[model samples]
Target chain A: MPYRFLEDVAIADVAFEAEGRTLPEVFEASALALTEVMVDLDGLSPVLSREITLTAEDLETLLFRWLAELIYLKDSACLLFCRFQIAIREGTEWELQATVWGEGIDYGKLPLKLDVKAVTYHLFVIEQIPAGWRARVVLDI
Target chain B: MEAKKIAEGIWEVPRTAKEGMLVPARIYATDKLFKEMDQGVFEQVTNVACLPGIQKYAICMPDGHWGYGFPIGGVAAMDTKTGVISPGGIGFDINCGMRLIRTNLIEAEVKPKLRDLIDRLFHAVPCGVGTKGFLKLKEDEFREIMVQGAQGIIRRGYGWPEDAERMEDAGRIPGADPAKVSPKATSRGIHQLGTLGSGNHYLEIQVVYPGNVYDADAAKAMGIDRDFQVVVMFHCGSRGFGHQVGTDYLDLFGPAMKRYGITIRDRELACAPFASPEGQDYFKAMVCAANSAFANRQMVTHRIREVFSDVFKRDARDLGLDIVYDVTHNIAKIERYQVNGEEKELLVHRKGATRSFPPGHPELAERYRATGQPVIIGGSMETGSYLLIGTAKAMEESFGSTCHGSGRTMSRTAAKKKVHGRDLLQRMEQKGIYVRAASFAGVAEEAGMAYKDISDVVEAVETLGISKKVVRLQPIGNIKG
Candidate 1:
């Protein structure tokens, strides 16, 4: 697993740390962690695809917006994604473009876990660790 | 930060406790309660005191716990002119609250049908994570809900018009500019108007405990006349609409903070000056989310009434099912308060705390004017809940705010590790509290042991006269998402 859950951080919310060699790789792992919090991603099939584009003034904000956009898709479209293909670029501004793949939620077939309210910036950090890029995200569940 | 006992059931962290603090941070708690609290609350409360234009003190209720920026059960009033508005202080679940409904039927009469009633309710109200609500509203119709709130639902024939007056702010806070709400928020809100979202959100059937009425006149006014009288209570918020609003603004305010020359200790505390354009826009959008929650709860109440009427084979009106009150604990509102004996308008942010207006307050309904606004505090499922009334002390000391519920003492993961859902279900069943949950793991996450003892927290407030106890209710059936 590229991501691990953080325990005892929040009374009511969930948190996780995702790591990879590149920004896009870490972003994908973070997205996976988010979906896994909602449902059993291993049993899910990426049968549908949705493209998302987000822009922010900084990399940290970009990551927050990206996760928030995924949550928005889950609530608005009732989609549960398992795969993420993401690209990140920084010049004068920060931008994230991603192709997220998931299928419509079939409650009878999928065992839903918890409803994540939103992403929180509490103790949120993204940095290039010695090995790769690492990000810590706390989700309000 | 160190706390000094200032009064019985009150502790104060002086301004000298932290740097940049404008005022002291006060916590309402007994000695034992204070010791039981997590240490993070001290830091969070002090951080809240550092906010610009913070009036009097940053207040934390007895049930306070560590939260993102402001501790859960935090309350602060900011000056409208120089103060700032923070989405963190308002919380992610905008207008998340509790609503009580009283039915004429007694517990003895409904005991045999409890399972059936819960089943019907669970089906009538779609629940669980990412579930779509029954209301298939068009885009314009949904926008109307964002603006009109509970009244909009009533206008659509989903609720009784009389129920509107019993709601806090008459179920609609004015100045809701729907256009300010983002397209993402609207999209998420369109299908989630009536859903009971998961994670500690629930609908419970409760009975008035015998001899539990502390104020007979007040309880009677709320339709709690006799022992064993049945009532329904549900906890939820603006659903996806509110979450999206908080998300969008956190992003907007992050950049806007630099332009306003504000610095925050935490990123989640990103805010803008209340009078700034960004602040005004976020406030308008927040109102829309708050209104959406009102509509959401009203729709759920409508469904509950329908389910009750269907199961009991009686007219809904004949059942005497009426709203007692709906109170939002998580919200920011502009209200006039007496500051230093001078009436001034301030923006009050109450996160994990409920507004408890005192007796004879003009904002209360006529029936409750002499009594006070009903403050509903929801305990964990295994524990009973309480109905309390506001006090003058709360108005004078804490901006008319009181604890919302028994704040969690255990993390969700820790709670899950401590209790198994199947075993919890059996335990509740043995205690005559039937529970139907969408997921077992979710159930474990909300184990009763995860929270502080509600009675202790309630006693702290009652002892301080912040809020007075009215009645106690024990749950008989519960539906969790």
Candidate 2:
């Protein structure tokens, strides 16, 4: 696993730390952590797909929008994803393009966990270390 | 790091505690609760005090805990002319609140049907993640709901005409401009009007035993005269729509802050001047979300009435399922308050806090004018909830605000590790509390052990005379999202 749940990071909400050797890998890991909070990935199959393209001024804002988009899709379309192919271009501006795969929720079929309300900015950070890149996220549950 | 004890249940941190603080930060809690609060709350409350145009103090209720930007159970009143409006202070779930419905049915009548009732309600009220509402609204109709709120549903025969009166702001606030709302928010919320979103949102059937009635006169006034009286309480908000609005504004405010030349310790506390175009736009959009929440709860109320009527074979009106009161815990409203003995209009932002307007306030309906606004405090599923009333002291001291719920003491992961979902269900069943949840794992996350004691949280406010207790309600059946 590329990510781990951070216990005690938030008392009422869920928090996770994701790490990868690159920006795209880190973004994918963060998305997986968020999805895992809602349902067990072992039971989820990627039967459907969605392509998301987002642009932001900075990597932090871009990460925030990326996770928030997944939450939006979950509520608006009742979809959940377990697989992602992400690409990130970083410079004065940042751009992200991802092809995500998921399936429509069947409450009886999937073992659901919690509802991720929104991606919050409290103690939200994305940083680069000598090893690679790491991101910390707190989701309002 | 130490705070000075200014009064009983009140602690103050002077402006010197932080470099940019404009006013002192005040926290209302018993000594025990103060000790239990996380260090983050102290930092966040003081961070709020540093915002420009903050008047008096940045305040936190006994239930205060670490949250994004403003601490949960936080309150701050900003100057209208000079202060700024931040979505962080109002919370992501705009108008996330509690609604109490009174019933003539007694505990005995509900006991036999408890399991059936909760199961029916669990299905009737669409809940859990990725849940869509029964109503598939058109864009124009959805926009109308953003403006009319519960009144729109009532007009469509989903609710009684009197239901609107019992809700705060009469279930609708003025200046809700649908044009201010974004298409993304509209798409996210269009189908969620009648849903009970997951995470700490629940609908419970409670019994008010005679021993629990503290203020007989006040309880009777609110229609809780019978021993073992039954009532329904549900907590929810604007669902995805409100969250998208918060996200949208927060994104916009990031740039707006730079344009206005304002800087803050945390990026989550992004804000803009109240009278600025960006600020006004977000406020108007927020009102739409608030109204959407009102309409969402109204739709749920309709379902509750239908379920009760179906189970009892009686008309809903005859069953006496009247609304006791509905109050918003997450919101920002422009209200008049006395600051330094001078009457001033201020924008009061309450995040994870309830408004407790006292007796004879012009904002309340005539029916409740003499009794003060009813304050509904929801406890954990394993414990009980409380019915209280606003106090004049709340107006004088805490901007007419009180704690929202039993604040969390343990993390979700810890709670799940400590108790199995299946075991929790059986334990609650043995205790006479039947719970029907969308997911068993979700239930474990909300175990009573994860939170502070409800009575203690209520005690702190009652001790301060911020709100007065009317009755206590023990849960018998519960439905969780």
Candidate 3:
């Protein structure tokens, strides 16, 4: 599974765990987990695309900024992204470039169930497990 | 971490409870309330006490729960000269606050029209996830609001000038430099004025229940003269504008911590010295968010007045829709408090806690100086809320702060799993409470069982003499986002 909801992690917020074999795949799964909190991902259509690029000092901060950028797009651009194509590179600094695909929300057809306010660092973890790379994030809803 | 009872409703976690704790941690809670608290609260509270230049003790209210760095309902004051300021201390939704509006009409007069009133109010205020607001301001106009706060909207005919007097900080805090706010935050906030953001934000129609008025004179001063008198209460904050400000600062402060030589237990508790350039910049930006929230609430209040007039077929003024008070729950303010019998200036951060200034405090407006600042506590949709007044004891003990609301006891996902939204709706209907939410899952997540009892929390504060109850207002109808 790309992502699974983690129960009982927060009193008023929601938590989820995402995994992939590579850093970019984990980033994609994390992005999908975020949108799934707002709406049913299966019902969403990727009708448009927007490119995004973010750089951070480390992989963890990179993930934080990546998720925050997606939330900002939803709030300012009024778009709900369902698919994420991410590429990560580590050199002098950690950098992420991605193209997110989604459509303007049709409220009548795909009503939002929750408003994920911000991705929090509480108990956030990213590591390489035996099976693959895994990341856990808690969202302030 | 362990706590020992220090007083009737107080518990103390000694400085030795954790390494590097500069001060002891205190919590105001009954045994029952303490049992319901999460273990993370113990860790977070102690971590707050470990911050540099922390004065006295790090305190948590009766409704304290687990949060990112500071536990929700946490209160801490730091020395302005040497202490550090953390963006996490004030939540992402900066100045997330409460405003209570009182009406002359009573419950009996409103029962027949409750449905129409709630429906009209719901449509009047834009809510829910990914929702835009009514006002789309130009860059200059948005910056004006960031600087001027509610005064900007009041000048535009959104509210009366007198309304500003009843608001905390007169609806504006000084030192709000619009230039300190990032362009991205401004864009997110431009079209979000007068909007109610989702997740625990709501507009509720309530009635002062019979025999629930604890202080008749105080109640009367708040425009609650008779039993079952109608009122409206809203819980919201600065929206995406505030969130972006926090996000930007957290990124800035996290790296600045190493430069300041501050060792923090949690990454979320990132900070810089108060006198440092980075710290001063964050404070200025925070004030901008706080002021913007004041304006946001003022605009919403104006929309509510318009909706009431339309539903009652009378002018809003004639309907007697007036603001009782507006109080911010999440914010940091510079205030003077007595430390070691000498008055000193300190930066007070109250996250998920409300300021409850006692009677005769300089902060109270002329009309409310004798009655004390009104402390509004919102309950769950199924339970009732309270109207409280600040007390002098709170000034001495908690720096004039008290519990914000009934804190969550269960996780949102757990609540959703336990209660079906349709079933919760039916249960509320049977209890004569009308709830309108954008999504059924939203209702399920906020089910009454998910939170602790407001009465228990209020009783603890009352027993501690931090705040006094004036009236109990039960919800008749609610609009949730």
Candidate 4:
């Protein structure tokens, strides 16, 4: 999903399906799907990079927290992730290690418009597909 | 995309003879505000106007920003007899709203311990994405939590029942049916109660700015006694539970759209007739989610009280850590109003906007009936926020709604480019505040400069007479999820 503009009236469950050659591309597509809920993302180039990390109880929690972290980075922090890497560490709980990159804040510099207020857990689930991992996250804009 | 003025601050967007349109779209904004409108706002709002049962108009407030089905500052009323309700209108966060608690703790008193207190609050209340609570529940109990809402939180002794009295509609919408909620939504919602989900959701400590009073007596009664009385403001919602509800309904409605003989203007605006079985189920489910959010906030307030009492070594009640008011910025509600000089019942939707019923309006809760409902506007940490009440013009123009926060002016990516999250944190701390965020970049993107000036946004609503200003609060300590 490269952030599409829908012409249909499909409220409630937002199905986000994307394919990329790498993990970063898939995550990038997922971010686009989230941003697409509020506005167009094609024109929204990478504006800045902000590092984010969320410690959770397990891999499941880590994946969910990862998206929520992205939303906060966008809405409250005003930074967007164009690149990302997720590393899982087995410890007391689970540590989600991530390195995110993007541009700086200058509304004037970006042509994109939309806000990902929060990451929602409505039908929000993450699992592995044959080729890659698939995650569904609902954003509260 | 040109915004042509139809009247003073009123812009008309006639239905473009689109196949799905039921009514025209209208926006209330000055030329200056129009210039600031997001490019997609026009398309999104126009799509809203095309809904099956949209009433006289699909209206957008001055603070309009791009949203799912409707713009963030959008207002629309569908006839219960003929119109439809989309979960998109209420948003996935459910009753994601703001609650302002005025305290006896003045700036001078808390300023010294602000660091310790914010850290305590941040720790006491679980925040960030996928954050669970200190309390967990079984399956059946979670269903009850959904239906009972804030009352459920109170039953657990999280807060006094009286706290519900200070909330809108006593913290529960009557029609909530927990059974209507999908099991998935239920499961996710269960552990999420009392937790603060990530993103713009946060708990902030604020100090009142000087000389901008609209109701001195009311402020005193609410316990914001000094110019810099420390007040707590936070934005959150039903979290995973709300998201599940929205997702479940969206899945339900996607296939059901074909039966309505309606051509949707946008996929996000999917809706079913309010009178139909599908629509009824969605509404019931949405109510359950709404109630869950109400309870979530109620429970958080309880946590705040506990943390404040522990940190300050005083009873929170004695300190007046009482709720001034709580309002839902994103929710669909049934309200009565005058349209074309005739009284009609409407399903008014306020997304990214708070209900601001004027003083003396019978619709307000008894506590707010005489003074009007408190409209809490949470701004960025660097900027100030406001406390306003509804006015006559609001009922007439916007279905009684006003802006919810300082609309985002910059994208997170852009903000991050300009400043490092770590550097921004240092700057914020130097300004005499404490900062707790899950991610440093998260804090950087939300730098105060990323949003519209609160003063300008609050003034737009007040100057238009939709809401009246009462108090101005400046952030002192904050947490971003």
C-alpha lDDT of residue B240 in model 2: 94
What ranges in model 1 sit over 4 Å off? none
lDDT of 4 by residue, A1-141 (tens): 443322211121233554445444555667667655433345455545555666765554565556655654443344555555656567898775667666543434444433344443343455666776665554543
> Model 3, range B1-481, lDDT digits (tens) per residue?
7899999999999999999999999999988998778887899999999999889999999988988878999999999998989888898999999999989899999999999998988888888877777877899988889889998999989998799988899999999988788998887778888888888899999988889999999999888887788999999899988988998898888889988889999888888888899999999999999999999999899999999998899998888899999999999999999988989889999999999999999878898999999999988888988989999999999989999999999888889899999999889988898888888888898988989999999999999999999998899899998
Please, what are the lDDT tens digits per residue for candidate 1 over residues B368-392?
Answer: 8988999999999889899999999
- Candidates 1 onward: DockQ, in order: 0.83, 0.77, 0.74, 0.05
TM-score of 2: 0.99
lDDT ranking, high to low: 2, 1, 3, 4
Clash pairs detected, candidate 1: none
Better of 1 and 2 by lDDT: 2
TM-score of each: 0.99, 0.99, 0.99, 0.80
List iRMS (one decimal) for every candidate: 0.8, 1.0, 1.1, 10.6
Q: What does candidate 4's lDDT look like per residue over B308-425, in tens digits?
A: 9988899998988889888898899999888788888889888788898888987676877777778889888777789887888888888888788887766665665788878888
- Misplaced by over 4 Å in model 3 are none
Best candidate according to DockQ: 1
| Clash count in backbone of candidate 1 | 0
lDDT of 2 by residue, B192-252 (tens): 8889989899999999987999999999989999999999999999999999999999989
